[model samples]
Target chain A: MAIAEQLQEFCGERRRDLVRFANLQLRDEALAEDVVQETLLAALQGSDAFSGRASVKTWLYSILKHKIVDTLRSRRREVPLSGMSNADDEDEGFETLFDRRGFWATEHKPHRWADPEDSLEQQQFWQVFELCLDRLPARTARVFMMRELLGLETAEICQELAMAMTNCWVILHRARMGLRLCLEETWFTR
Target chain B: MMNCKEATQLMSQELDRPLTWRERLALRLHNLMCSGCHQYRQQMAFLRRALRSRSGGD
Candidate 1:
């Protein structure tokens, strides 16, 4: 098949996963779709630039990630961090799990979760996890994904979001706590 | 004496940054004595692994 035809088919097949990945990062369907489209376009147009150093999926995903970051930077002006209220800011719900001295409250101790390796292979587990992620406030979720999903450094994330380093860490800590509690309540609790 | 709350924060921070000697010692001493904090640390690691795999190690 011609390179153009092959690239077209490749992009066609990978579009959904690419868009879904973008949606996970950006949290906006329209923007996610737009970035995915741009990613596909860049991949196909620059197909000759493909060095074959990485798999097609990985290459496409790298492009998608760049596009997602670009979209995030552009949209940064519209969504200020202060305007993105944290869902957990109203209460120290997780703190109640520990006593005044910092020990786990008897009733609030964490239970051992099912084997993570097993759960990672289970589609239902990811569904529950995704739902929990979706429940986080927009800014928190974006910051979390930028660090965890994109593997961006703290300095990079702070620069991208125009947020302070301390503020970034606080958001990340809250995101982790929120995710932990959400998973415990929804998936781990029998 | 580190509590579960502080230990959890350290656990989460460990994923993103290097822990200071004081924070490490506190968490280590706390985890040594507390089964619940140990479990919390394990769960947090599990969460990071899950997210990394899903992101294709991006």
Candidate 2:
């Protein structure tokens, strides 16, 4: 099969997931669609770069990740930092998980999370995972996605987001804690 | 003694950068005595692994 035909077929099959992944990161449906469109067009033009070592889906996602990050960077430039800073303020909800003395609150103590590795194989588990990711505050989710999903270094993330290193760490911590709690409540315990 | 809050912060930081030896010692000591924080660290690690595998997989 020609690389173009292969890519067109692949895109037809995976476009929805690609768009969902972008929307999850961008939190904007129209913007997500635009980015995915850009990604597909890039993939078509650069089909030679599609080394067969990685699966087509993974290759597509790598392209989409860059487009998403580019969109985010340009969006950041347009918006005033002051307006976004308030949204990024540490959420007090995280503090509720810990007591005044800084111990885990009784109701929020971490559970053993029986056989978490096994859950990764389940389709339902991914649904719960996406829901948990969706529940995170927008900026928090973006920061977490940039670090964890896109595999950006903390230093790079700080520079890209125009945030202090310490602030980046705090946001990542909040994301991990929040996702942990959400998965426990929604999947592991259930 | 490092409390669970501080210990968990170090655990999360461990993912992003190398922890100082002192920070590592405090987290290790806290994890030794505190099962909750210990499990919290494990869950964080699990989250990272799961996410990486998911992205890298078809």
Best by TM-score: 2
lDDT for each residue of candidate 1 in A1-190, tens digit (9 for 90 to 100): 5557656765676567667778887877888888878877887779899887666666776777777777777777887766766664565476688788877889988778877778888889988999999888777898999998887898899987777887888889989888988998998884
lDDT (tens digit, per residue) of candidate 2 on A75-130 = 88897444654455756477888899999998888889889889989989988999
C-alpha RMSD of each candidate structure in angstroms = 2.5, 2.3
Q: Candidate 2 docking: what grade?
A: medium
What is residue A143's positional error in candidate 1, in angstroms? 1.3
Q: How well is candidate 2 docked (DockQ)?
A: 0.72
Clashing pairs in 1: A102-B3
Per-residue error at A71 for model 1, in Å? 0.4
Model 1 off-target regions past 4 Å?
A1-14, A86-88
